[model samples]
Target chain A: MEKKTRVLLFKPGLDGHWRGIMTVSKALSEAGMETIFFGFKTVEGVVEAAIQEDVDVIGFSVHSGAHLEWARELVRELEEKGARGDFLLLVGGVFPEQDHEELREIGIDGVFGPGTVTAEIVRFIEENLGRKVSG
Target chain B: MEEMEEIRRGLEEWREAKKGWPERREEFRTDAGIPVKDLYTPLDMEGIDYLGDIGFPGQPPYTRGVYPTMYRGRYWTIRMFSGHGTPEETNDRWRLLYEEGETGFSAAVDSLTFSGVDPDQEVHGAAHEVGKEGVPLYSIRGVEALVENLPIDRMSVALVVEPMTSAAVTSMYFNVAKERGLRKEQLAGTTQNDILTMTIGYIPWGSLKPADLLKLACDLIEYCTAMGEAPRWNPINFTTYNYREGGIDAVQEIGMGLANAVAHIEELLRRGWKIDDFVHRLAFHLSAHRDFFEEIAKYRAARKLWYRLMKERYKPENPDAYRFRFHVQTAGSSLTAQQPMVNIIRTAYQALEAVLGGTQSLHTNSYDEAICLPSEESVRLAVRTQELIQEETGVANVVDPLAGSYYVEALTRELEERIWDYFMRIEEMGGVVEALNTGWLFNEMSKAFNKRRRDQECGAERVIGVNCYVMEEEEPTPPFRTNPRAAEIEKERLRALRAERDNRRVAALLDRLRGVCERRENVLPVVSELTAAGATLGEITGVYREVWGIWQLPFVA
Candidate 1:
């Protein structure tokens, strides 16, 4: 039996913009990935859960313009736990395109901004994780 | 009967003649899925009576305009929703908008303030979002700084907070007005204390149960309007705009709004209040979306439906209770991030729809809002967009200029029936509160989100920059950055306030608040005193959560 790629998604901080993250979660699930939606969590809590669940991808969305701050906090939490390279880190939300490089520099593996299609995200996950997502 | 027969015969000939010409698409429908014909004639308006259905302005069934003179007497107030970084910075922005000819002010608070959490709270890194989404008004001092040196006595201000913190934040604003030598009765403002905003529009953290939220919402209306505490202030504005931005069409938008208003009305009535006590002070906030004619008809249908609801159900004696006055905001969901300059044109057309629909107030979205908060220059352009409509365009000169158009009148009649039908469906589900508890409203929102995503992906709904006329690679606009030291500054302000305020007095008042919550009484009188004594939002709402436990939403992915 093929092991299904597991992905975990959440909303970091207290921003209430959940449509973007929920849409991505449903899309990934439809594309045949084992997706877990941890609704609202702290960076430290999300890191601990991702490691315990053995998820291949850990994604979070930010629409409160605190993308840089949250991205840095998540990276720091993972590094402190010696799990920086254990999972593919992704961040998506309503942020400027110029911030993509800064987010990547902060150790984020995938950066999706506004106007992102769900298929593009599905393709990104499959290509990066080297697993074929069957729908 | 003879005249109607003649027009019907002529319309049949015209329909046959139009069959030879090729149409643009196989079918035409409004954004709400109402089928549209190639042409509308006098026959389409078959049973609609002018006097009974579309009466004169300011009369029953206000289909034309709410007021007799509409924009001819005075143009709609340009009330922009704005805030950022800190209360001081937000005040500066308010002054800029005032200088640029804005008539009203609206405060947009941050997430910490929205959820009744202070920056120093140990929950979920609340400090990171201190001043990120909007201005942080944690304590009474922040609200005072937000309206400092402004003519709040003359111009109306809108505090956009929801049920969880509406009592706390609104009391802070009222206390500030009183200290500034303005009587509470003389204050003119609005509190966006809608329950659905926090529940369905955008789910806040630590939200109360739906029934508890209703109690909090009706408490404000009971305090300000029914109790005559702030006679001129609009205690609650049913903000349908927030939910519409979540991808619902115009019909669902107004349907949900009407049902939500009914929930509050029933709650107040159950509390032993007459219908006329707070019904006249009820107001609405609507959205101006993509469909040009449909949006215009929506405003008209909404006015008529409100009049009908008041007449057939409540029958308030006050004439003003029947008037469905609303503020329209250009749809933020319609704007695209690619080729951001095109959002200017989109906003302009939507603004015209509001003007023609006879809105009482308007707010135009900035072109760069799809990416980040608007830059100073971009916000200035947004204010100018509304100015162009009022100054350059002659659309607002006449009241309800398109009142007699065949397409508009017919569409208005069609929409009224459809919206009422949808409203009844909600009423059948035991009204809005029961629907919230059953997770029915959330299901509607989730379905809309998925359907919209599918439509855009398959090219069924063509967004200019996202689907068609794509731009390969372009220079990104310079994003506006918020103050980095906002969190530190706000925390310091809170610390200073705690040291200066009388802690013993605040604690006693908090104890009184707990008793009020236990007995389920109005919290305004005690909350006003607490805010004046320098109690923060977190402290006031913390008591409510302790008394009535937090709600666990029946949310599914």
Candidate 2:
């Protein structure tokens, strides 16, 4: 049997809107991924969870229009931890369509905004898993 | 008999029209799981008494509307939910919205406010929290700045806050009102005092536990009841918006809202407040979801069910007690960042549904909100969305335009029955507080959410931009730049306020609040006095934090 992919979903901001992440987590579970929701964590918290959970994917969702600052800080946090590019790093929630490329430059692996189908997300994770192992 | 024969012949024609329409691939149920038949006819609404089930506007059941002239008498208040960065920034948004002909002010306080922590106390270096989500209000002075220079008498101010902070936020308002020479009775505002919303595990913790929050909610309601006959003082807007957005369908939203309302009513009744005294002021913050008919029928059925429930069960003497006056906001969950411009159409339709469903007020989400906190241009455009509907479209000429439609009426009836079934299930768990605590309520929400997820995954549902319609390569929408220094500015203000305030006096007032808490007396009036005496929001909320410590959702987290 193939090993199940473990994904840690972190709400990396204080925005109390949870529908996006909750829905995505549900989708990941339905797609047969092992999911952990680190409810409302800091960037450091996200990086720490990546180490602790030994997960294949880490997705941060920031909806308060502060994703630029949050994403930068998370990249810095990962670099400081010497774990940059160790896992598949994804970002979601209320981001402009134009920022997907900039997100990749800033060390994010994939960008999933609102209305991106969960099935597509599952596929993204599946496709990205080998990259994490090879890296 | 002739009309029946004409309907039967029309039904045959409808069936013929629907034959081979190529819609087999579609899901056949509302989000509530009620099957959507190909055609609804007189047979669908078999025994619904028009007058009894769908009452006239302003009459029993109130299926049509709460007011005789819903928008014609005047329009529903065009409210845009606004708060971000500093109180100064939020105040700027308020001024702009008010100047742009928005009618009401809804305050969205920051996350620290929800936890009863002052910015200085807890969030010093938290980059994301510096008014990123909402204004960081920590004291009487904080709220004072938030509402500074507003025409208090002309506009109804609604605090879109939670339970534990109700007393603190209300005190901030009362103190400001006193400073402005306004009496308690002269105030008109609402506090989103539904702790049941908190228990849905949306937020990890509120400042207080479930039981404490309920007592505080009852206290605020009773405080408003005692305040002399000043109309429009909405004490509580029982919210199922967050719950529904959390994945529950329309039926559960109505049912949970009804159950939470009754739970408050029961508590207030036990405290010896007449149901008529406070029930008139009860309201709802209902979500306008994507299903146009389901959303419309949900609002209609909510009002009718509440009326019958209040009349038959509690028996309030005032007719106003039965009317479920709700403020609707477009479902934030329905917005999409892909082709973000399409969200404007989604919001317009949702706003129209709210207007047609006879909402007392409505808040339309901005097109770019799926990307961030609404930019100024987007918010202005959102405000314009409502104006276009109100001015351009003649939707408001008649009240409840879809009142007699066989499909709408059938949906409304089926929704009402299912809502009652939900109510019974809720009651079986001893009531809302127990249901929420025992994970029973979350279980229901989980089921609702899981069903929705399955539907989305299996292509049973189409979210336009999300599932079926492919925006192969999305154009780059404008990026939103957040104020990184908002935290420092807000904290500096807090520091200056703390320095200016008389510490000994503030401590004494908080001690008095603690005494009031111990005596089990009503907490609002005492806190109002302290706020008027120049105490901070953090100090007032600290009393609660001290009393309750911090509440944790052991089941989910």
Candidate 3:
């Protein structure tokens, strides 16, 4: 059997908008990734899930303007857990295009905003997984 | 079977008659999976009587219109939903709309208030949205300021709130009116006290369990029915607008709507309340989406079906209870952020369909909705869009203008059939409450939402400027930025109020609420008292949480 990549998808904020997360989760799973769904998780909960699942990527699907704060806390959480470099962190949802570079500067591997199709996210995770393992 | 075979044979011969015919798949269908015929004929709508089924305007079944003259008698209210920055800010916006010739008023609150949490207590909020996404209605004082100088007695108010927080908000509104010397009998307003939408559609911040919310909603209805003689307040607007945004098709939107209303009616009936006491005041919140004809048919079918449900099931004596009056909002989900200005044209078509479908009130989404709360310029354009429809276009001059068209009639009948089919299934599943509790409705919505998103992504479904007619690397307009100081000012105000208010009196009010809640008594009286006594939203909800416990249900899918 091939070593299929595993991804952890989490909802980090309050706006219980599940359409984006639900669609992305289904897409990742259908794209042959072992997806672990984490909802309403604190930054620590997300870090814990990522480490426990041994996921290659952790994606936070958030609404509102809280993505930056959540991503920062998540990066801090992973750094505190000593696994900051082990997993790639991607943040998606409702962020303005200008905030994308700032989010990546704060150690988010990639940023996907609203109207982003599922195929792009799936491909991004797969390619990032390849870079992580091959390196 | 023989006649069916003969027609099928003729169709096969007709197909063979064309030598260079295009290889077209005859499976063209609507978004709701209703098959679209090549051409509709009178045969498609057989066995349907026009007068008995639809009748004239302001007549039985109410399929034509709820009023005799329809828009000619009175134009549908242009109720633009505006709230942000603070209570005072929202109040100013409301006054502006009134000055702009808008008729109806809605007081909207931010997520923190809606979730039964104080703005100072937002857990996941980055502080950017505290009072800016909507008003920070954390205190009765704040709520009073929202409707302070406005005419509470005369205005047709629609509380832009869900059931989870409607109890607190509704009581607050009544208290404000009372303090302003307006009797409850003079109140003309609506509260969107829909529990199904609260639990399943808009996954709100954590609050009371679904069962407690249902009981609280019933309490409001009962209080309104028993207290004020000739009450004009609607205790609930069973909503499908919320559910539609969660990813169901047009059929399921109205299906869930009818089923959810049945759930509410059944619950109230079990309490031995007379149907006429509350059913007349029970309105609906529906959506006008991109499915133009389908949406029009959906509204027509809903009115016809609800008339039957109210007449046959409960048998209310008041004919007013049978007429369904609904408010429609152009679907925000249909708007695109890429070519945001195109949303104007999109909204124009949607608003037209809503008017054609006989909505009583309408809110056209601003072109900037997909990016942020509507900007003032876009909001004016939206209001003007409605005015244009009302004054310029004579679409609303006739009642049920599309009633006789073969496609519309067939689709309306088909939608009725599908809605009844849902009723049977929901009945067998015990009811809508059971369906919601078992996550059946949530699962159905999630599945639909996911599949629709995937289809749009893969070109199976088309959304302009999203997956089709697309622009590569298009520049997005600047997102609407919430004033950062709004949170700051609101949080400080909350702290000062807590420090200054009579904590003991607040405690007593909360205790009374808890007592009523525990005894399963009508909670609205105590809720009104609590709001009047300066009890903060968090404090009242704290008492409820202590009584009903907290529920943290995620979306089923």
Candidate 4:
């Protein structure tokens, strides 16, 4: 039996937009990933859940302009705590096109913009996981 | 023999196609959360009435439109949601929009002013978000700067105001009109004074308990109607779009919206006012979402349901009272923040749906709405998108263009059945306000909203950026950057107003307002007085909060 890909999904702000995050969570689960959703968590709450869940991938979905700052802080915290290697950092939301390179430099492996298909995200995770599963 | 045949079929298909299912598979869900089958036929509709349900445009029930000629007679008003930072800035933008051929203005105020707080108030905090999301006007002086040199008589204005302390803002506009000597009848526009919709979305400013909110709402309705702002001052907009963005599907949005309307109508009728007197000015602000067919069906169902509810439930003698006319805002939630540019395409689709759904007026979400406030460049594109649809598409040439189509007609009926069923559920839950108070409505929206995320995560639904079409390297358009000093400019305007204006009269008018609100008396007349006295938005809201006691809901994620 193959072990499931454990994924944690969360929104990092009080902003009430749940549609994008909800759709992405559903897609991940249907792609055979085990998912736990932390609804609208604070910065501290998200980092705590990351440590507790010890998931393969941690995704933070937010539209507020705090993504770059949050990612940098999270990466710094993870590096200090020696948990940086365990999780692949994936970030998505109204990221300005110009900030894509800057976000990558902060340890985000994948960035999804509008017009992206679900299959591509699934493929990104599968490739990142390095576990080839044939259905 | 049967087993052998199945094996052979499977083998042949596997050989021909590497994957068993179609190569590009995606799950499609309606805006109403209805699962769409491969095809829908005439059998789906079963029974539908064209004349009774849709009718000729500009006729009874108004399923198509309230006007006979719709866009053919006159185009839907291109009302840009303006007003951000300060009065002067908003006025400059308004003048530019008008010059660019916008027919009307829709003002979005900052949280402080919208909630009825003065710019200098401690409640505003250091981070004054004025002009960031909406225009922050402190007094009639601010209003003057916002609408300076504009043709108040010729151009229609829609102020996106919640009734927390809106009397001052509204009164200021009226005072300006009066100041310019424009006839009350010549002034045409809407004040989005819907306290219910504002309350539901969890605005942190001054809110009211259900009872007080209802009273304030009634006060505004009565004030506007009796003050003879008959054609203008659209005090009621049963806004369900907020619910939809919160995660309630189309059916729930419409069902709850109607229920909300029912509560208001019941309150007014109980007060001994005839329904016909107030129902005409009542309009709906609906969400024109991306789901093309579902949105169209939702509109059609809303018309049929509202007409039946008025005729059968209320039994109003006036024909016009039975008609349901509404303005549509393209779904802001549907636009992705990820692929920002693609939002334009998404907005176009939603706009097309609005046209097909038959909206009275439409406001397309600017492509950059998800990231920041729209710039003039983007706002123009949004308006031009609509203008293209009107002038070039030839879509508005006919009435209910898809009225009798098999797919559209069937979808319309299924939607109606589901909505009526949902309406019964709401009624069972003790109507709109009760359900809202109990968090039933919030829960429903949250559940669906969360489910959609789960589906996207599991590949059941495909959102272009988050789930599919992974972009390894790309550039997102630079968001329209606003001057960070917008709030400073607005604060200066407020400071200037304090130096000006009648201090003694303003104090007296504010006291009068407090007296009426405390007594639960008709406060509109006093509101007019307060505005005339140059009482600020914050002052009016402060008085209201002291009386009504702001609503503190158990916060929901």
- Candidate that scores best on DockQ: 1
Candidates sorted by DockQ, best first: 1, 3, 2, 4
Query: What is the C-alpha lDDT profile of model 4 across B1-557, one tens digit per residue?
Result: 57656665766666667545563436556756676754554444445566776678767666666667867777677777776667777888888888888888888776666667665665513233455557776678778888899988888788777666556677788888888987666777777766556655534344667667777777777767644663576776777877677666888888888888888888888888887778777878889876788898888778878887888888777677777877888988777666667878888888888788778788888988877778888888998899889889998887678887777777777888898898889888887778767867666765777766556657676667656774654555567654568756767776776678778888888888888887788887888777776677778877888877767654343
lDDT (Cα, tens digit) per residue for candidate 4, span A24-101: 776787778888877645545666777887778888764534467667766877887678877888887655666778
Looking at model 3 chain B, report the run of 10 residues with the lowest lDDT sum: B124-133
What is the C-alpha lDDT profile of model 3 across B60-107, one tens digit per residue?
878877888998888898988788888888888888888888889876
- Residue pairs with backbone overlap in model 2: A94-B371, B85-B131, B138-B537, B139-B536, B139-B537
For chain B alone, what TM-score does every candidate structure achieve against the true structure?
Answer: 0.99, 0.94, 0.94, 0.91
User: Per model, how much of the real contact set is kept?
Assistant: 0.78, 0.50, 0.37, 0.15
- Clash pairs detected, candidate 1: none
lDDT of 1 by residue, B1-557 (tens): 89989988888888888878998899999999999988888878789899999999888789999999998899999999999999999999999999999999889899999999999988888888888889999999999999999988899999999988999999999889889988889889899999988888888878889999999999999999999999899999998999898888889999999999999999999999999999999999999999999999999999999999999999999999999989999999999889999999999999999999989999999999999888889989999999999998888888898987999999999999999998999999999999999899888888898899999999999899899999785789888888889999999999999999999999999999999999999999999999999999999999999999888888854
The Cα error of candidate 4 at residue B27, in Å, is 8.4
Whole-model Cα lDDT per candidate?
0.92, 0.79, 0.80, 0.73
Give the RMSD in angstroms, all C-alphas superposed, for model 2.
3.2
Among these predictions, the greatest lDDT belongs to 1
Q: How much is the lDDT of residue A90 in candidate 4? A: 86
What DockQ number belongs to candidate 2?
0.42
TM-score for candidate 2, residues paired by index:
0.91
DockQ of each: 0.83, 0.42, 0.47, 0.12
Which segments of model 1 are wrong by more than 4 Å? none
What's every prediction's RMSD, in angstroms? 1.1, 3.2, 3.1, 8.2
Tens-place lDDT digits, model 3, residues A70-126: 788888888999998898788877667778888999999978876787878877876
